[model samples]
Target chain A: MNLKIEKVAIDGVLVRMPYNPAFCADEDKTLLHGGVLTALLDSVFGLANFVAIDGISSMATLDLRVDYLRPAKSRADVMVRAECIRQTRHIAFNSGRIWFDEPDQAEVARGAASFALTRGEVSIFDAMTQSRSSK
Target chain B: MTPDLATQQLRKVPFFQFLDFTITELAETHAAATMPFAERLIGNPIMEYYHGGIIASFMEAVAAISVSHGPDLQPPKPINLTVDYLRPAVKGALMAEATVTRKGKRMASVRTACWQDDDSRPVAEGLYHFLLV
Candidate 1:
């Protein structure tokens, strides 16, 4: 699924997912699946890592832990913001929170993840720059 | 719920349907499932590796199914989930097996592992905690 980026800064990113039946858990579509929520959290945290590393490198998740504080009510847009809390030479720690509507609203879930920085021939920044230059 | 009922309920989850995860086996304390490799499941398209989130989702679903089919007989609410990605999940069908370690009145714990080709070599593993209510 394509995640919508609401904002991106040096330290963090905010992503939004408008409720879709594909994201629902029950046949009745009353609840969003926890896996979908985890996917959102995971993406945001990964993007936070990108921002943290100045987009010079790419990373992959080593470990991710999520706590579901409450069921994410169905048919509501969900927003998540993730920030890199710490970084080392080869790893980054990130924290994220999910909300149904407003940012200040009670969180439906929270998560933390650690990512391993990958040294690759192509950096995300390089790809973006190349794409923009081509355009 | 009986194992059969829990398995049926698991199939109803939209994410499971989206990922094409099939519950291959369901027992009182254990559950097994499989996910076919697909382009949509790729996290690193350049590398063609399964997305970590997709793998975690698969593991979490299997863990939940294991608990749901246990003596509790109720669908669980996830309290927390931790996934450790040991290796890049390459292009192939991935299998997951989950076993319940503890089932209490209010909480339950499950451990799950996923493998692509070799059952002994896991690509990822997870520990899941759920609320029994």
Candidate 2:
């Protein structure tokens, strides 16, 4: 998934994912599969956790729950807002919502997740950013 | 529908085509599929692990097929889902099986599991609910 971070801060993040025909459900490419929304939320949640929580070695998703409120029908880009609500010594909690980029901005899905964290001297964020920049 | 026939039908779905899975087993209340690993499916760039969402998505696809297939042209409405990640999936073909737990006039519940090698050591398990109306 080619993701664009439109906005990011300690509180949360706003991401935009363009609609790709490959992820569409029907032959007409009118509606997107719910799985794409799930995948998008999963990715955004990771970003949120990386930004919100300070210092860690690694993180892994423990579980995720998503509710599909409506059919993901639209040709416009999809916007996702995610935040890490709480953090513990070895765990992180996240919540997020998704919508189309249209004016109405109708919500398509809502999701929550928890991640198992390993705290260390080096942060996963720095590692990832370094590897990304190096490449 | 026969597995071969179901595979043909699935090709029409763009997302399924993108996932590039083949229907291996199809029953009245169960469905199974296999998806080969691809570059785009990797979530952890450094570790090269299969994205947790892709595993959930694959299971959801199989679950939907288990719930709605045959004469129904309209797909089942996805209401909600919960997924538990048990292990990281390495770069290899993934298999998923979906079993319909309960089906009512207005709703249906499905359970799904995905694995790369041994079925006992699953990568993930999911519970999905769909609106049948």
* CA lDDT of every candidate: 0.83, 0.92
The TM-score leader among the candidates is 2
Evaluated against the true structure, the overall lDDT of model 1 is 0.83
Per-candidate chain B TM:
0.89, 0.97
lDDT of 1 by residue, B56-109 (tens): 888888898888764435579889999998999998899999999999989999
Expressed as tens digits, the lDDT of each residue in A1-135 for candidate 2 is 679999999999999999899999988998999999999999999999888887767788999999999999999999999999999999999999999999999999999999998788887667778998898
User: Model 1 off-target regions past 4 Å?
Assistant: A102-104, A124-135, B1-9, B70-73
lDDT of 2 at B80: 98
DockQ of 1: 0.69
* Model 2 pairs whose backbones collide: none
- Across B18-113, the per-residue lDDT of candidate 2 in tens digits comes to 899999999999999999999989888678899889998999999999998885557898999999999999999999999999999999999999
Off by over 4 Å in 2: A123-125
Candidate 1, residues A6-76, lDDT tens digits: the string is: 89986789988887887787778868889888888888887777777753367878999999998887566
Indicate the residue-level lDDT of A42 in model 2.
93
**Candidate 2 colliding pairs, count:** 0
